[model samples]
Structures are given as C-alpha cells and as structure tokens.
Target: MKLLRVGPPGAERPVVLDGTRYLDISGVVSDIGEEFWRTDGVERVQAALAAGTLPEVDVTGLRIGPPIARPGVVLCIGMNYATHAAETGAEPPEHPVMFYKAPNTVVGPNDDVLLPRGSAKADWEVELAVVIGRRARYLESPADALSYIGGYCISNDVSERAFQLETSGGQWSKGKSCETFNPLGPWLVTADEIPDPQALGLRSSVNGEARQDSSTADMVFSVAHLIWQLSQVTVLEPGDVVNTGTPEGVAVSGRFPYLRPGDVMELQIEGLSTQRQRLQSAEQEA
Candidate 1:
C-alpha cells in the first residue's frame, strides 16, 4: 500500500494511494504517525481497502505533505555508498557513519527548499529513506531487521558544504538540519510491496541536468545490516526515520557547481516515489 498525507502544512490528513486516486483513511486512522504505526495502522487500512468502505478524496489542488507525521528522530547515515565517499576524498567506513537531522527540517516533497542567507555551497543528495514501524533493540540479527521497517520513500538529504565541512569542526548536523533541508515523500510504499530493499534505483537531477544517478546495490551497508548495526547502540522507535545515505554526484565533489537560489532539485527511488523541490532564500531569522 502507498500511504500519503495531503492538505495544507499542518492540516494534512492520512490517505492511501490506489493507482491515481487517493482514498481517505482518516476515518479509519488518524495521521500516519507514531500512534498509527504502534496500533497496526497498516493492517487496519488494508482491511478497509479490502472491504471497499473508504471514500475517494479529491485532492486536486491541496498540498502533499510528507507521508509520515513529524518523526521522533531523523537519523542519517553518511558515505554509505563507496562511490560517494570516493568523490568526497574519503575511504569507505568499516561501519555505517551515522548523524542526525532535526525533525523539524522535514517538509513536503514539492515544497521550496530554503537556503540560508549568504549560503554559497548548498548541495543535493538523493537518498532512500527507511521508516521504522516497530521498536528495534539489541535482540536482533541483520536477518531479522527487515521486520522492523514499515516503509520506504525518497529523501533528498540537502546539505551546506561550508557549514558541514568548514565551520562544523566535524559535526554534520548544523548544515543538515537547516529548515526544509529534508524534503521527504510523495508516498510511502509499504514493506510488503518492496521485497528487496537493496535492488532499487536512486537518481537525482538539478535544474533538469543529471547529478546523482545510482542504485541501492552500490551501497556499502545494506538496509537490514544498517538497522541491525544501529540497534546494538540505540533504540529505533516507531515513526523514526533513517536516511540511508546518498550516492555520488553532488556539488561537494567539485564536479558540479554548488546550489544557488532558484535552482531546482528532483529526486527519485524506484517503486517508492519522486520528489521535486526548488531552492529559495529564507527570510532572516528573528
């Protein structure tokens, strides 16, 4: 099932995508959020669809919000793709390199991506985001990790090179947690629909020109392994999001010019969905 949320920013209601039409599931469940996942929301929605009781919602001009509600935590893995690591002059790590992006940074897929004032090195990173459905702790193996996932979706891990590399003194969250830095979802394809998470193709383009075009197959750490590895140290709770790193071809590599106001980014992961966001300057902070 492809789950989604549609409406104004704070008014989004849950729905399920059936081909081109969207069926209102708000009557069956609240927003696709932590509580929804904890109560077997997917199974309830599936049952509603099977019983043919859901009504079609006309979302002709409403905004499409992120599929899941605000996550408790937005975790990110960096340099998981060997080629991406090589492009940035780093060697592949022995284990997943993890970081965090503020949960507030998440915006709707088609929303404008805001660039901080005077920013000169903003960049785009197309990644496959994993959404957690169940609590994941130490009692696990890589083989059991798949059961903890709820869905998969597209994520553009937008970054600011200067803040991330130059002024960060080594921490990555500053550049990564900027407002609207994470544009997620057009739809969250349920786990059952994706039997093999490692086989999807991920690609991104800037202003219609190709940037990162790669596949999950190139990732040094597979989805299940990353989850299992992370569980050993931290608990992955329901509705937490994990961005499984981006592929090669970002401005940080010096091959492409860094993003500026007005530049647009388009990203896609096969079978999950696509996201398109335009870069814009943010108003000065109060």
Candidate 2:
C-alpha cells in the first residue's frame, strides 16, 4: 500500500493512494505519526480501504509532506555504497558507519531546502530510506532483519561539506542537519509492495542535469545487514527513519559544483517515489 501525508507543512493529513486517487485516511487515524505506525496503522488503513468508506481528497493544492510524521530517530548509514566511499576517498567500512540527523530536518518532498549560514558546499545525496515498523533489538541475523521494517521512502541526505569535514571534529551530523536537509517521501511504500528493496534503481539531478544514477545492488552492506547490525547496538523503534546512503556522484567528488541558491534538486527511485527540493537562503526559513 502507498501511504502519504498531504497538505501544508505542519498541517499535513494522512492519505493513501489507490491507483491515482488519494483517499483521506485521517478519519480513521489522526496522522501518520509514531502512534499510528506502531499501533498497526497499516492494517487499519487496509481495513478502511476494504470497507470502501474512505473520503476522496482533491490533492490539487495539497503539498505532499514526509510520509511518516514525527519520525522518532533519523538514523543514517555512511559509506554503505562502495562507489560512494571511493568517490569521497574513503575505504569500504568493515561495518555500518552510523550517524544521526535531527528529526526536525524532515520536510516535504517538494519543500525548499534552506542554505545554512556561511555555507557554500551544500550537497545532495539521493538515498533509499527504510522505515521501521516494529522494535528490533539484537536480531539473530541479517536474514531476519526485513521483518522489522514497515516500508521504504526516498530521502535526500542534503549536506554541507564545510560543517561535515572542516569543522565538527569528525562528527557528520553537523553538516547533515540544516533546515529541510532531509527531503523525504512522496509516499511510504509498504514492505510487501516492495519485495526486494535492494534491486531498485536510484537517480538524482541538479537543475535538470543528471548526477548520481546507480542501483541499490551496488551497496556494500545490504539493507537487512544494516538493520541487523544496527539492532545489535541500538533499539530501532517503529517510525524510525533510516537513510541507507547514496551513490558516487556527489559534489564532494569534484565532478559537479555544490548547490547554490535557486538550484533545484530532484531524486527518483524505481517503484518507490520521487522528491524535488529548491535551494533557498537560510533566512527564508527563519
């Protein structure tokens, strides 16, 4: 099932896409938040759809917000893609290299990403994001990791190289948490709908020029393995957002110029959804 949150920024309402139509599910569940997902929101939405009593919403002026509202933890995996690591002059990690993005960075897919103060190296990372459906702590093996996931979404792991490399003393979160840094979702495609998340093709473009175009198969550590590895150390709860990492074509590779005000970034993943963000001055958000 494809689930989405539509409306203006903070007032987004939950809706489900049935073919090309968006049905309002807010009557059944308040919003697609932690409580909704943790309490079987998927099943409830399914039942509501089966009953054929949902209201059809005219999504004409409604903005598509991040699919899962108020995600608990925005966990990210770095160097998950071998080529991406090579492009940034880093070796493949022996294990998943993790980082945290402040949850407030979550914004609508089409929202304008604000350029941080004195930032000149704003970059784009088109990543496949995994949304947790159940709490997982210390799983048995990688084989059993998919069971804890609810679905998948598209996440643009926007960053500023200066804050990430030249400043923070090796902590990556500083560069990763600017306003609208993480543009997530057009929808949260349920796990069942995406039988194999690793085989999808992902691409990103800056101002209509293609940049990163790669498949998830190139990942050094698969989704299941990352989940299993993460579960070994921390408890991943329902509604947690996990950005799996991007491909090689980022600005840091020196192949393209960094993002500037008015630059448009578009991200696409096969079968999942797409996201586009316009670069704006930081004060616009202030």
Candidate 3:
C-alpha cells in the first residue's frame, strides 16, 4: 500500500492510495507520527481497507506533505556507491560512512529547495531512504536488521561541496543541514510492496537533464548491513529515517555541473515513489 500525508503543511492527515482513489485513514491513525507506524498501524489500515471501513477521501483537493512527520533522526550514509566514489576520486571505505541531518530539514515533495547564502556549489543527490518501524539495538545480523524496517521513500540529499569539503572544521553536516535539503516522499511504500530493495532502479534529474542515475545494486553497503552496523552504537527507534546513500551522477562527482538558482530536481526509485523540487533564489529564502 502507498501511504501518504495530505493537506496543508502542519495539518496533514493520513491517507492511503488504492488504485486511482484515496482512503482517509486519519480517523483511525491521525498523522504519520511515530506511534502510527510502530503500533502495527499499517496492518490496521490494510484490514480497514480490506473491510471497506475507511472513508473515501478526495486527494485532489489537498496538498501532500512528507509521508511521515518529523523523524527522531535523519541518518545518512556517504559514498556508498562505488561509481560515485570513483567519480569523486575517493576509495571505497571498508565500513559504512555515517552522518546526521537534523529533522528540521525535512520537507514535502515538490517543495521549493532553498539555495542558502554563499552557496555556490550546491549539488543534488538522489538516494533511497529507509524508515525504521521498531526499536532496535545491537542487531545480531543483517537479516535481523531487515525486520526492523517499516518501508522506504525517495530522498534528495542536496549538498554544498564548499561547506562539506573546503571548510576546515568538521564533517559533511555543515553542507547537509541547510533547510529544505532533504525533500522526502510522495508516498511511503510498505516493505511488503518492495520484494527486493536491492534491485530497485534509482534516478535523478536537474531541470529535465539527468544527473544521478543508477541502481541500488551498486551500493557498497547493503541496507541490512547498514541497519545492523548503526544499531550497534545508536538505538534505532520508530520513525527514524536512514538515507542509504546516493548512486553515481551527482554534480560533485564531476560528471556534471552543480545546481544553481531556478534549477528543478526530480528523483525516483522503483516501488518507493517520485518527488520534484524547484530550486529557488537565496534572496527568496531571506
């Protein structure tokens, strides 16, 4: 099932798409909060839809927000794709490279991406994001890690090369935490819908020109391994999002030019969904 949130920004209600129509699940599960997905809410909604108990909602009248509310953490993996690493002139690390992005940076699909002040080399990276369904710690194995996931979504990991690399201070968080850098969702596709997460084809384009285009098959670290590794140190709570990492074709990979004001970005992954974001001027952000 394709689950989503629809309405104004802060007032979005839970909804499920069934073919061409939408069923209102807000009456049963309110917003896409932590409790909603953690407490078997997906199963409940599936039962309701099967029993014809949910009310039909006209999705055409409302705006769509990110499928889930503010997650507790927005974890990210860097250079998980070999081709992407090669393009950047970096060797693939033996272990997963981790980072964090504040939840405040989360925004809806089709929202305007802001070009932060003094950001000249802002770039785009399309990645597949995982949403955790259950609390986990010290996961025993890769298989155990897969059991903790709720579903998946499309995420644009917008970056600023100058802040991420040229700056002397810290990790990539500076270039990554800019507001509106993470545009997630058109829908949160349940895990059952995705037979093989590793087999999905992912792609991204800037202003109709293709930028990042590759398959999850190229990921240096698999999804299950990432979850297992992360759970060893930090607790993975319900609704915590993990951006698995981007594939080849990012601007910083040197295959293409970087993003600028007025450029639009569109990204998609099989079974997850697609998203479009328009780049706006820094003056507009001010």
Estimate the TM-score for candidate 1.
0.98
Candidate 1 wrongly placed segments (more than 4 Å)? 284-286
Task: Score candidate 3 by lDDT.
Answer: 0.89
Instruction: Show the colliding residue pairs in model 1.
Output: none
Structural similarity to truth (TM-score) of each candidate: 0.98, 0.98, 0.97
| Tens-digit lDDT string for candidate 1 (1-286) | 9999999999999999988879999999988989989999999999999999999999999899999999999999999999999999999999899999999999999999989976889999999999999999994589999999999999989999899989998899988999999999999999999999999999999999999888999999999999999999899999999999999999999999999888989998999878999888896332
RMSD of 2: 0.8
Candidate numbers sorted by TM-score from highest down: 2, 1, 3
- Give the per-residue lDDT of model 3 (tens digit) for 1-286: 8999988878888999999888899878867769987788988998999899888987776778999999999999998999889989999989999999879888998889998888888999889999998998999999988888898999988898998889827789999999989999989988888767899999999889887778999999999999999999899999999999998888886668888888889998988778999899768877
Candidate 1, residue 257: CA error in Å? 0.6
User: Once model 2 is optimally superposed onto the true structure by TM-score, how far is the C-alpha of residue 198 displaced, in angstroms?
Assistant: 0.8
